[model samples]
Target: MTENGAQLFARLETRPCLKDIEPQLFPEGGGPNHGEVVELYGTEGTGKTEMLYHLLCRCVLPVATGGLEVDVVFVDTDYSLDMLRLVSILESRLNAGSSSSAESDEAALRLCLSRLLVVHCSSSSQLLLTLHFLETSLSSRPGLALLLIDSISAFYWLDRCEGGASAIRQEEKLRKCAELLGRLLSDYRITVFTTCHAIKKVYNGPSSGSGYDRPYLCRPWQRLVTHRLLCSRQETNSVAPSAGGSEEQSRRQVFTVHCTSSGSRTKAYRSSSFCVTDGGVKFI
Candidate 1:
C-alpha cells in the first residue's frame, strides 16, 4: 500500500538525531565516509575519555542498539587510561542486558569482547600501527568499523614530545603529523574519534589578564577534522558536600558537553548533567 504524507511524517518523527538521543549522541546515516575526521576536545577530567568508552560500548552492541556490530580502534597516547575500569563497565553493562533471556542479545556481549582492539602508543610511528590493524581486519569478511583516539593533543605537548624543540619547527611537525593521520583515517574508510586538548590562550586586559581555551587550538589540525566538539566541565549535580578549599576525597569537576559541528550548534539534546560512576564511566 502506498503511504500518505502523514504516514511518512510520522515515520520521520521516529528517527532520532544525535542531540535527541542519550547513548547515541552523534548523528546517524552519513558515516564511514572517506576524508572524515572527528575531533573531541575538552578540559581536564571533563568526561572526554569516559565519553569515548561510552561510545565504544555502543559500537559493539547489536543493531537493536544502533550499533554496527563491528570492531573499533582505540589509541591511548597518554598515561591517563584505566583499563580495569573499562573492562568492569563493559562486563557489568553486558551482564545487565544479557539476563533478558534472549540468546541473540547475549551474542552482542560476546562479540564486543572479541572485536574490540586497543593500541597503546607513545610515538607517531606507533600511532601508524592502527593502519596495520585495519589491514588485518580486511582479510576476514567485511565491515570492520570505527577508530578512536583519546586526546590527540598529548602528542603535541612539549612535555609529551621531544624536548628543546623550536616553535616553528614544532608546529610544522605537528601540522604534518595531523595531515598524515588525517589521510590514513579517511582513506581507510574507518571512523576516527580523536580527542583533542585545548591550548591556553591569554587575553590581555587593562586590570590584568585572563586565560581561556580557544575554540580551535591548532589551526592546522582543525582544518583536517570533519567534526569538532568542545567539552567543558559544567556544574555537577553531585557536588560533594565540602569546603575549606579542599575535600576528604579528590574533588572532581563536572562538565556540560556542547557540540559545535555541521555549521551550527545542535539542539534537541537530552543530557542535563553526567555524574561520576564506578567502573570508569556511565551516563547517569
Candidate 2:
C-alpha cells in the first residue's frame, strides 16, 4: 500500500524522540535522535567502555527507575565487556532509586538485563554479518532504540594485514559495515553509538589537543558519523588527604572527557570531566 504526502508527514511527526542518555556529556539536553550516529574516539584506558556501560544502563532500566526504558544492542568487538561490572552499576542505580528489598532489586536487575542484547564479533567480517543479523532483529522489535559498537576500529590492523598493499581491499570490510549501518538507520530509525581508538598521533593539527586523533578509518565510516566525540584522559591533582592516608590517593584517579560535535545543528563544543570508580563513570 502506498501513502499520500500528508500521511507520510503525519507518520514522521509521530515518531518518538529518544531521551538523553548522558546529560553530563551532552549538557544541552537534546540527545542522539533517530537515524543518528555518534562516535566516541580516544586512546585506551580513557573510560570509553565505562561510559558505554553507563549509557547501556540508562537504556535498559525502566522509566520509573530513571532510565530511558528502551532496549539496546551492544556489539562487543574488543571483547572487553565486563558483565559483572555492568550489573554492579545497574544494581547501584536501582538501589539509589528505590528502597526495595534485595530480592526485588534482583528481580528488577534481571528485567533490565533482559532488554540488552550482546553480540560478540572477533573480526570485521563477523561484525558485518552481525549488523545484518541486527537488521532482522530490529525489524521485529520496535522497542530496540539504540545500537552500540564498542571500538568499531577493532579489526583495523587485521584487515589491513589481510588486504596486503591494496588500500581499497584494506578498507573494504569496514566500508561495507558502514554502509550496512547507514541502511539500518534509514530503515529502523535507531540511534547508533560506536567507539574508536586513537591509533595514530597528530602534530600541529586542528584536532591535535581536542581529543580527536588522526583519522585512521575509511572515509565511509568517517562520513557515517553524525556526531564525533573525541575522548582523552589525564591524571589530575591528588584528592585531599583522607582517613585512609596515601592509600586513597594512589587508588583514585580523575580524568577529563572532551566532546566535540561535527554535523550537529548547533555545531557546539563541550567538555566534561569524569572519574571511574567501583560503581561506574561518575561525572564531575
For residues 1-284, write the lDDT of model 2, one tens digit per residue. 45655554454454445647788877657567788888888888888888889888988888887788888999999998999999999988898848789899999999999999999999999999999999778766767888899989999999999999999999999999999988878867888888988876556855566434567799988888877777777777664666866535454566666676667476767788889877788888
Taken over the whole model, the C-alpha lDDT of each candidate is: 0.58, 0.82
Model 1 score (lDDT): 0.58
TM-score of each: 0.68, 0.89
Per-residue CA lDDT of model 1 for 193-256, tens digit only, reads 7787766766677643334335544566777666655666755333344677554544555656
Candidate 1: count the clashes: 5
**Could you tell me how far off, in angstroms, the CA of residue 220 lies in candidate 2 after the best superposition?**
0.8
Q: Where does candidate 1 stray beyond 4 Å?
A: 1-24, 27-35, 64-66, 100-110, 129-141, 159-165, 204-211, 215-218, 235-254, 263-272, 279-284
Positional deviation of residue 129's Cα in model 1 after best superposition, in angstroms: 5.1
Candidate 1 TM-score, true structure as reference: 0.68
Residue 69 error, candidate 1, Å: 1.0
Cα deviation in Å at residue 83, candidate 2? 0.4
